[model samples]
Target: MTDLELTELVKEISLADFGKAFKHQAMFNRRLRTTGGRYMLQSHHIEINPASYKEFGTDELVGIIKHELCHYHLHIEGRGYLHRDRDFRELLEQTGSPRFCSLVQSKARTKPVKRYIYACIDCRCEYARKIRMNTARYRCGKCNGKLRLKSE
Candidate 1:
């Protein structure tokens, strides 16, 4: 969502749940890597990770919003707003917000490992390759040593 949309969502949640108004900014911060969202204590702004919505959809997005609101409301009211604070934990439980911001697990990679290690028999020069090279035709330039497959 755009910054304006995020602002609206935060305002809505604040009013609905906390009976307060969110007077600060809320935006989707593309730079957020692992955290689903963050509440900026200095700016009193909320930053949501765009990847969270892209990967998990609106339901997940709302949860993140709720999580940030927990921080926002508590901090603005001069109560404990940190995750470890008693007030923060109580507020989260009262608001039914998640204790921690959820993260989108990154996609798994399946690329094959470069399993073969090759070495020149005479010069001991080493090489690594994903695919086995033809040792019969390949030789060490330094010593003209025949290359051999040393390990997989």
Candidate 2:
């Protein structure tokens, strides 16, 4: 959705969920990584990750708006607004907002990881590591046996 649509949605959710008006701006931010949305403490603006709406749809968008609104309202009212604050948690539960938004599947890494397999020469104990290790120096933890590269 457009920034105008997002701002309207934020305002709507704010009024509906918290009985408060959101006077600040709400816009989609492509730079937001890992978080669905963030409430800017200094500007009181809400920035939502566009990837969230694109991946999860309107229901998730509404949920993110509600979550951000919780932060906005609490901070404006001079109450505890941080995630760890009682006021924030209470507002989340009260408004039925999600404590955490769903992960954007598109942003997640889909590449298969390559693992290096090693075996203890004496004990036959095996070990797997993401990075290849020097078998000459690294030994088995179980019996302290010399290790050898088995497979990748």
Candidate 3:
């Protein structure tokens, strides 16, 4: 749906589910990457990832809206709005909102496996690392022994 329709739907959901009006803007944010939606504390605005709807459809969109709305209402009312807060948890349960937003896939590749191995000269303690380490500057954690590049 369009941004305007998204905003209207958010408002309707806010009023119907929370019995409160949503006066802030709700817009599709293409830049949003990992999470389905985010509630901005400073602007009191909700930004939704467009990919959520494209991948998961309307039910997922509604669920995300509900999750953000929990943050929106609790924050505006000066109640606990953070995920760890009791009020936020209770509001989420009361509204049947998802505890976490659905994860969004990205085009970025996974990190390469670690290949470098460093060993302590005195203790033979080994460390696996993805990147090269400066042996001269670094020492073993247990014995402060000199470290050497053991293997790739």
TM-score leader: 2
- Order the candidates by TM-score, highest first — what do you get? 2, 3, 1
Those runs of model 2 whose alpha carbons end farther than 4 Å from true positions after fitting are 109-112
Q: In candidate 2, what are the lDDT values of residues 24-93, reduced to their tens digit?
A: 9999999987999999999999999999998889999999999999999999999999999999999999
Give the candidate order by descending lDDT: 3, 2, 1
Error of 2 at 51 (Å): 2.0
lDDT of 3 at 12: 96
Q: Worst lDDT window (10 residues) for model 1?
A: 101-110
The TM-scores, one per candidate, come to 0.69, 0.85, 0.80
Error of 3 at 4 (Å): 1.4
lDDT of 3 by residue, 1-76 (tens): 8888999999999999999999989999998777889999999999999998898889899999999999999889
Model 1's alpha-carbon lDDT is: 0.86
Candidate 1 C-alpha RMSD relative to the actual structure: 7.4
In candidate 3, list every pair of residues with a backbone clash.
none
Q: What's model 3's overall lDDT?
A: 0.91
Q: List lDDT for all candidates, in order.
A: 0.86, 0.90, 0.91
